[model samples]
Target chain A: MGVSIFGLAWRSLMNRKVSAFLTIFAIALSVALFLGVEKARNAAKDGFDNTISGTELIVGAPSGQINLLLYSVFRLGNATAEISWPTYEAIAARNDVAWAVPISLGDNHRGYRVLGTTQSYFEHYKYGQRQSLAFAEGEMFDDLFDAVIGSEVAKQLGYEVETPLIITHGLGAGGLTDHDNRPFRVVGVLRPTGTPVDQTIHVSLEAITAIHVGWETGARNPLADNIPEETIRGFNLTPRTVTAVFIGLKNRATVLRTRRDLNTNMTEPLLAIIPGQALAELWQVMSTAERVLLAVSAFVIAVGLVSILTSILTSLNERRREMSILRATGARPSHIMTLLIAEAAVLGFMGAVLGAILIQIIFAVAAPILSAQYGVALMGTGPGLVDAYTIGAVTLAALFLGIWPAITALRRSLADGLTVKV
Target chain B: MTQPIVSLSDLSFAWPGQPPVLDVKAFELNRGERLFLRGPSGSGKSTLLGLIAGVLEANSGAVHVLDQDLTELSGGQRDRVRADHLGVIFQMFNLVPYLSVVQNVVLPCRFSKRRLGEVQAAGGAEAEAKRLLARLGLSDEGLLSRNVTELSVGQQQRVAAARALIGNPALIIADEPTSALDADSRDRFIQLLSDEAQKTDAALLFVSHDGALAPLFDRAIDLAEINHAASIMEQA
Candidate 1:
């Protein structure tokens, strides 16, 4: 049988192994970067969307929609204001509300946000297709100082069921007084949800009020030292103010009416947002950055292809004699073009596959860190259809990119057939 | 008696935006004839070979090889004729360096169905390639597998010759095929190439500036004597 032209192309590439490898590596790295960025973007959007999947409305003190979603669901930037206890009560009493999980923030446990809420949070708070939180180890918080820690918080802090979790008076990395005397015990650790909830320490509303009852304003009272945990039940621990209330409507159709009522409250101005719409709005805000990332990666791929073109064109000068040989052996100008195109296609395909393997290796190393720090879970290291599409598009682009050098080779062969310059 | 293997009539050619380089009123090479074409550098030696190979088309008139009027054929049809009926060898030993000696020898058969069919009739492409190489005294088993880059200049020359003579093409065009060889190897190479051409019953046109090689061929034609453009160039 005749030697396949593709086989010839392969042999030609193998002839210049060093340049072929360099070109393949450049293309692979660029493809890896493009694929990595795209995966990270999708993972981030998935994490955000999974944060508060079933919440119908988020009612908070009148604030920006993005801010309310951020502080309430994402545990991102803090809410500028708080919804009053009376306003929260009135909203919770409405017939349209099925269950409301009021969130009282402004506390942290070793940098993980400490969310103060009722048992309703553990019971009704849903995420990722209305999947309720399941404990990885133990049961929900029952005692006054009992804490339900998210999966990441437990993993990072190495907290077990009985580990003493000290709550801080505020949210930042510095200058916050710790409630060391009234430490909470880790009661439960939630399973990985790939959401903000995985990064929070959940405590009851009474604990939020109990920890700061004696602190006058932001200052610690010297006389109110060492309040015993046993006596905490003796004190009234009703939360007077919460940051936001996540409401789930009894009927999905009543969401608009309830939102309008909350927004038009005469007693106190409140902001209500459907969590899904807010998340979509957040995606809108982030889509620009996503597009920029894709654009930059695409530009890098273009640069990689240009480098391939340059390498091939440079080799074309050296291969002028080779082209003449092919011409002498009965190859037409079109055959020369096909040979170059085939070589480039092989390079592109090899690079894409190498890049995919590289990406999987990178994700394997970075997955744990990403989940721990950003709550963005990279579920698996396998390639998806999008990855296949990317490789296909890149290979096709490479075939097209080969035209310049192929044309150059064709012209050279036609001009210098079987002629030795010497 | 048989139609000439190659016939050019009133052929004229020139580089674009340049004066005519070749104006041959008539040129013919009979079947199985070996013709030595002598010309100086820049005297249209390579240009005439290009026209004969169908790589270049004359400005006026026709090049008929194996009874096909190359001027009447489309560029692609001319390529087909070149592939099926003609073999070319260049002076620089243009063996695709990455390919094995066997691979380089069989390359013509890769592009031409007719050549491939001929090789198949001789058992297989590789076998025919090996047969031709052995006829040119390149039968070392190790050398056949080695890349052409590893071969000596003379060995490489034999490989090029084997490639050109593989499929029993009607005509063989050799452009300074021995220019890069030493005198001993040059004579040996020409003997092997001419012997292979005779075995295949193919007409041979060997172009070179060296006049010493002319006596070995069936006939010698000084290109300056026939290319009218050469006389005009000499006058200017």
Candidate 2:
């Protein structure tokens, strides 16, 4: 039986152990970075998709789909117009509407966005497979001044149930209009959903209206500012307007009709958009940035391949004598070529496999940090077909990269023969 | 009636874009003959080995080894002939530094089925390798297990000789194989190599710049007397 050519290749590689390992290490790092970027991108998309998964339609003032999605789901940018209380009630009363949960934004509490909604929000609002929000501690808010904090807000601020926190009138880190007279006590903390909900503080819509009762048109009402907090119960606290409403249709067939009716027949200029379609459109705008990121990562992998070439070419000079020695042992020039190519292939295969393993380890360690920071959950499944393709491509590229050295070695073996000067 | 192990006629070779390096009108080595070829530096000693080993094809004329016309065979066919019928020992690079002594010795068997069969007939390739190493006065198990890098120069040279003698190739080519050994070790190595060649009935073509080792062989030829290209280049 002929001896294994791979056995010869492996022994040759072992002779130059440091260069082989260094080459493998460089390739592994590039693969990890490539896989890491792709994984983060996927996880980010999953987080965005999970944010408002169950809301079939979103109703807000006439605006772009991406704009409405951004302000409604991601809490990005201020709403240009608001839906009045009567309009929201009329929509909620429509026969096609299963539920309409009003969302009142434009408030901040310690850098966390404050979302004011009714008890119906906890009952009807759903995310990530139509799953209802579950409280991690305490129960849903029962009073106008009670607030329920999301997991991230509670964790970041170290707030417990009944921890009093004041609300600021506008969104931002430091808003001048602080509602100091009325502070809401944290009544519940929601479990982590790996969505934007985790970044928001929830309170009753009545509390939102009550907090601004003494103010008029973004300015304070001096006459009511001095009124005692005890007598605030006597004032009317019905919400006048909401930033947007997340609506679920009574039937799947009614979604288009309801969306059209809300846009064309409403008393005010309003727009109703399919949340999924709007999110898709939003993703289109973001895809360009995503493509740029992937391109950069691809260039990084290319650089890694070049390094593989450099490593192999660098060692070819030193291994010239070794090649001639093999020739003297009855190894054909073709065998020398095969040996070099096989060595590169082994390095590439090992580097790719090690990179895949490294990615999983990084995900395992970074999952929590990603959840807490970006609200993205990395599903730690083993390498998929895409990873296999990447590894295969890298291996193939390494083989191509090895050809240069293989040819050089073949030429030197033919030229040098038994009189290898080195 | 037996044919010579090697024969060359009107063999001429040159590097790409250079004048001819070897121009031999005729040369021959009979079976089992130990011939020492001495050449000064730049006298085409290594180039002749290349031609004889079939590693380099002549620009004209025919070179034969064991009745096979090397000029008529493909490059791969030449390699097969080298693997099956010839054993080569270089001045350096005698053993792959990473391979063990036995692995180094059994390398030819790995490439040639004929050689592998010969070793297998003697039990196995590794067994034959050990037997050859034992005859070369390197029988220690510890020495056989060591990486070639850890072996002494004399030990490495012996290992190379054992490798060349394995599978009993019909022809052995030694290009200054003892250049690195001490005087005593070199004499011992040559004696061992001669005995191994005689036992296998393999022709030996040993080339070296040193004339001191020429007395050990059956016959000797100065390359300066045989290669017309060397005299012509010197005159130019």
Candidate 3:
């Protein structure tokens, strides 16, 4: 009446401070994992959804759609074949077609992908709700020897306007050969969009053309045959083939007809696919992984809750005295039950708070790694509306699960006499 | 308008599938009476205390406290009547280990709103608890703040006594509360408890097997002389 039962429960927990602390810790870690996994899942989805949008269809070599999307859009695996220049020209000149941008991927600049495209890429290419790419500094490439670097390339490699960049003949670190003679000038740097585009170095398709003018059979030409960089600009530098093409249709209604025409009626083999379907398929593959992650975290939470149950249940035999003391001092059996249940509820609330703190710590360490490795953006840091709901659910579950031990103590105290053995 | 604090008539009890352990014909402690009942261990003193506290159900006859037949009340009602009326003290482990001395002393009021109301009218439970503990000679501020488990046996017994006497309950049941105290402090403990109980005009039912301390109470009864089942169990 004067001293509150909640206070009594808290003091009782404090009496067993070590066990209580361990319980809170286990619950906090599980909660952090639960919320962290959820954050990563959301970031992965958002990153994929934001990568490239507003394009009606992607056209590429006869390779599978995922492969073509991987190399052209994602810059993941290498493209095994190329679409002829006339095929790209034919798709660009279609009646329903609006514009086309060629993507030629074969070179790398210091671990970043090299993408050769026309000025149409900066003009028409869109991402994340049809947002256009804006230059952070400088402007788009103007000549066959000019290049535009992405935000990460500039930030990581310390490139700025007039920074000379050498394109390697192949992908990855220390590839087959370096294009030392045909080095390009950094003309522009685009702002970060949290997409793979941030990892690309852009140039005119002719820039990809002029670099290999002396090379044959995928190797460097002899020293005598190597053309000097000063005289190479006039040598008919047009791309003969391209890795992929992004096609946007002016008339949205004729996409299927145009795709069918390209896939079935073209002299050159080609593949046209709606990006949404491929993205959905990718999500389907990823969701299974997410489900496994969710199940694992759910079990961890269950283990955390079970530890509370075990802690209380085992303490009951010894706590019989505590319960009897309460009962003898005018407390009823229901008060004892409330005392135990209230203890668990308090621990659960503390667990939620600790979980929030722990999740912020995890996100702080994971954000940059995620952005760099997977291009996923991890945005929020603390508990949100959904997090509050989850905390409530976990706390309520702890309180609910706490009843078994309380009921057990109640039964024993009822059976035992008010006279304590000690 | 004077009435006995507790009256039992033809009470008999036993654990299930066992012989009768307690059978008493008649017993009563009058208003403001301090009665000592001496019974050695295994004489069913604990079972009697449990029944009187409304924590146990008698197999037959009536167990009455505060003029209410405990047999006629539901389990919850009995718990309520106990909370509202009785203040019990065991021989040892009397205080909740986690609570401070004052918290232990005021714990009865947390369960009994009636007692809480009485405490509040007396200028708050903390002040009333301090008054009771001071009477029991445990008024050290440092001592009061420490956990009850850290208190010596004599101090623990005094704290337990103060707890029982806090809300002026209708009946104070102390079962061998001085069993752990030395001879010197045991007598002092009883004097303090009885003096505090008399101030509230609350009846005391003190049970202990030690007969030497029996003279400190207003009256005394021997369990073997009154409980027929004790003699029966001895004979069989």
* lDDT value for model 1: 0.86
Candidate 1 Cα errors over 4 Å, as ranges: A172-176, A378-382, A420-422, B230-236
Share of true Cα-Cα contacts across chains kept by each model: 0.67, 0.61, 0.75
CAPRI level of candidate 1: medium
Which runs in model 3 stand beyond 4 Å of their true positions? Answer: A222-226, A379-382, B230-236
lDDT of 1 at B161: 86
Model 3 chain A: lowest-lDDT 10 consecutive positions = A374-383
Best-fitting candidate, scored by DockQ = 3
Candidate 2: pairs in clash: none
Per-residue lDDT of A77 in model 2? 87
List TM-scores for all candidates, in order: 0.93, 0.89, 0.96
| DockQ, every prediction | 0.62, 0.55, 0.71
How many clashes show up per model? 0, 0, 2
- Please rank every candidate by DockQ, starting with the best: 3, 1, 2
Model 3: DockQ score: 0.71
Can you write out model 3's per-residue Cα lDDT over B1-236, one digit (the tens) per residue?
Answer: 67788999999999789788889999998889999999888888998999999988999999989889999998888888888888888888888888888888888888888989999999999999999999999988999988777889999989988889887898999999988988999999999889988999999999999999989999999877768886456754
lDDT of 2 by residue, A1-422 (tens): 33478988887777778988888888888898888888777767777777777788999988888889888888778899998999999999999999999999988997788999988899887887888999999999888899999999999889989899999878756545788778899999999887778889999888898888778678667676778766776777788899999998889788888889999998988999998898778887888899898899888888877776787788878777777777888888778889889988888888888888898888888887876776555653357887898899999988888888888888877888667776
lDDT of 1 by residue, A1-422 (tens): 64688998999999899999999999899999999988878877877777777789989988889998888888888888897888888888888899888999988977899999989888888988899999899998888889999989988989989998788878755344877767799989999888888899999889888888678578677556666666767988888889999898999998898899889954899999998898899899999999999999989988887778888889988888888878878898888999999998888888888888899899989898877877677753468987899889889998998998999889877777557453
lDDT of 1 at A391: 89
**How far in Å is the alpha carbon of B12 misplaced in model 1?**
2.9
After TM-score superposition, what is the CA distance of residue B165 in candidate 2 from its true location, in Å? 2.0
